[model samples]
Target: MDTMRDRLAPVLTRLLDGDPRVAVLLAEIGADGFTEAGRRHPDRVINVGIREQLLVGAAAGLALTGLRPVVHTFASFLVERPFEQVKLDLGHQGVGAVLVSAAASYDWPAGGYTHMAPGDVALLGTLDGWTVHVPGHPDEAETLLRHAVAAGDDKVYVRLSLLSNGDALPVDGARFRTVREGRAGVVVAVGPTLDDVLTATQGLDVTVLYATTVRPFDAAAVRRAAGAGRADVVLVEPYLAGTSTAAVNDALTGVPHRVLGLGVGRRELRRYGTAAEHTAAHGLDPRSLRERIGGFLGAAARH
Candidate 1:
């Protein structure tokens, strides 16, 4: 099981060599990974020395010059801290850039809340024309990276976290794929949440839909999978809870159904521990996730 970063980090070299318009904007992260690329393409590979604002701003400026800029940093710095720069420099200016994030959600809980960005996807969703991808595996992550660059100025957000599934699936860009089929209900897993979602719905009669692209929401595919839009829909995300609630609500509008959302909780745990510890604290571990699904669908066994 290759990690998302392991898969994506190499794409920088390919992009630099293949396309002159491609640029990699870094905010003091991934320096070691892109050292060779920076040396080879001195003009395109830029590190702004921990300044998140300048990272986004420079990417936007590069885009203004008709260059395709790929910005990389931790989730919090990439989205939360320099958000205004992202909004105005990129979104407001109507210029396009690809924002790639690692250490997502609580993947770096030891780094504390300052590094935690459960709201990155939700916040970026507010911006228009963003093709958000949360690939469960590295192959998928690499594919999305290539897709974003080939798109030519299409705004893309690639969320690379420490968590990942066991296997890889061929991604069709913005489409969602069925992990398993059933009739009782539908359990939709976004990004790395697939493994836990699969384990939680083992005995339940529900369809599991895996999605790497969440911003586009893929409502049509989701509705079609729902089979008349009646099966209970459960969205299991690795980020903020209820982050996709509105999109889901609107997607299934006028169709009778029940929805359940599970993810990082709203309240801050304020504890230092491993990512798994934070996950369990927020009721996102396998056992807690199973209980939420079981109770909602009325499974006979508690576990």
Candidate 2:
């Protein structure tokens, strides 16, 4: 039951050792995991001691010098805190880097709202030309990480989560993988929500799409799944609710379609609880999802 973060150190260490152009910038979070990598390549592995802005700025600087930079931190600090830098230093400057994030949504509920960033993905949607990878399993994370590193001056965000599916499905890091096929509608599961989505949609007639790469919004895949008719799409993301709803709407443009976006709710829960509790509170648990999905698709579901 190793989380994606558990796989980061080794996979990144291998990447750093094998490629001379790969550099990592950290903001004191997960810096301990890269001790060996820092020792092996002092100039490449850098920790800016809690300066999240500097972490992104330095990564952008490295990218400008023809180096591929992998920046790591919690979702909030990585994307939200230094967002201005992410927008200007990287996007505006036209530099490319790999932004890897941990602590998906409310993974560490005790850490409170400051550490939780359900809006990270939605916030990044404002920028252009960015590739977003939300890996459901550790294996998928490694695969997407490698792809991001070798993207050749393309902006990529590899969002690693403490949550994961029971197994790793085949992910090309470019398109969505169809886990199951049906005709009634399509349930697009982004990253770790695949397991719950599978469970929630059982005994129901609907297509299940597993999306590791979300930014490009695999429109063609959904179009293919929905076929040449009125499409019903349910986007289950692990971030802010309706984060991908607009994208789904845009994808189904000109075709009659209805979309239901489910994920962490906008209402802030003021209690400190386990991640499981948070999931249920947000109506993202399997049972709640079953009811919602069944109601939306107008199909009776069995647990």
Candidate 3:
């Protein structure tokens, strides 16, 4: 099974060929993947060396010239290291660009903490008018990538990951799709966490929602999924814990709702272990999630 990162080059290549306005900017990361595209459209496909700041600034500059720039790099360098450029270059200028990131969370554990960006989504949440998409499967990633590029000068962020679900859910990259329906609670799974969430919530009486596009956070869908009684929501994100807690709370305004935000913890583990080890340490594995989700919902039911 190909990872989301594996799909980036082919999809972007197709987009670049089809759309004249589409441009790709890289920071020496994943430059080899675009060799053919760069040869075909040298002006559109640019590699600005190892400078992460230039990657974003150049994308914004291209957007300024009426071209839709799709920027690529690791999550940490693309979003965290050059965050100021993301904010001012694109946000402040009111220009649009597609910032597609690779290596979600602890995808490259051996690369150290600098490569791991568990807070990328949360950090981007601080900015306004940005659409965030965390696709669970490569198919979903391709769908969201095309959606972002064709969005007509809208600021978009497409998060790619080495982690993927067993199967792809039919997602249009706009709204949340209902995977399962129940009455006890609602489990909103983001990106690669969907498979784990499904495993954890199996046989539990709860509505499971698959969200690829998180930013315009489907508040109405969440409200409807919560049913007419007490809302017990467990947001299982692949990023920082409680990243979407505020959005869930606001969705249930004036209503009784209990939200349990389960994700990558703030404590950084210094050991260079495998990504699976990191997932277990963060308490985001299927076993840990099952225990936590059950306890949270069971406790709410008792009250």
Candidate 4:
């Protein structure tokens, strides 16, 4: 399959060629020189220093002028700094703009807190009229990006992590997949964590669900997966606990749901390491997740 960057480059290039009114706002260092080498129409690339707020504001302005703007930046700065701009400027006006965030979670190593952002899943999910997508693999990313651009929603946040060379999951459009459909238990995995979930529950007799769209989660499908019997559901996310996991649990009501959150706890994370190392340290690694799932299953079997 093609790399995430390769898949996106062509689609973005085609968008530029087809739409003269479409503009792309990318960070100075984050563009990775794709704009220069790629086929971008003349003057369509807008570089807004390192100011995250300015990036969103400029995109909002561009949207007001009937030009579709795609804002690209690190997840940390894109969501935190320009949150108000996203909420008021783009969200309030219902201006169609796509926020492309990279290095979601601790994808980058040694970049420290300034670069690592695991809370975007939760933060972006809170906005009204804003769709949140966390693609697990390159193929899914490509398909989702194309769909997001074509859908032309007012506000949309697409979370992307470093493309892992591992096998890509089969994703068709916006539909989520059920790895194992059983009435015993449900394990909902977002993004690449689907791999981890499969690995962790090797011999377990439980169902695994892969969800790409966190916001406006498929309630009907989830209810169907839960079945009418008493089932135990668990959510696995590469973000802090309070956001995605809590929200999913609350949505599942009556059903016994548990959240397996990765990254820092309630306190701030002060240590610096690679995404894998950080995740391992915080009990988000495959081994940790396996143990957690085993425990959940063991307890469930008791009663």
Best prediction by lDDT = 3
> Residue-wise lDDT of candidate 1 within 124-191, one digit each (tens)?
98888888999988888898888888887888898998888888898978899987888777888998
Q: Write the per-residue lDDT of candidate 3 for residues 227-301, one digit (tens) a residue.
A: 777799999999999999999999999889989999999998999699999999998899999899999999543
TM-score, candidate 4, is 0.89
TM-score winner, 1 or 3: 3
lDDT for residue 278 in candidate 1, whole number 0-100 = 86
Ranking by lDDT: 3, 2, 1, 4
Residue 163 displacement in candidate 2 (angstroms): 0.7
- lDDT preference between candidates 2 and 3, better one: 3
Predict model 4's lDDT versus the native.
Answer: 0.73
Better of 2 and 4 by lDDT: 2
Question: What ranges in model 3 sit over 4 Å off?
Answer: 299-303
Q: With candidate 1 superimposed using the best TM-score fit, by how many Å does residue 204's alpha carbon deviate from the native? A: 0.9
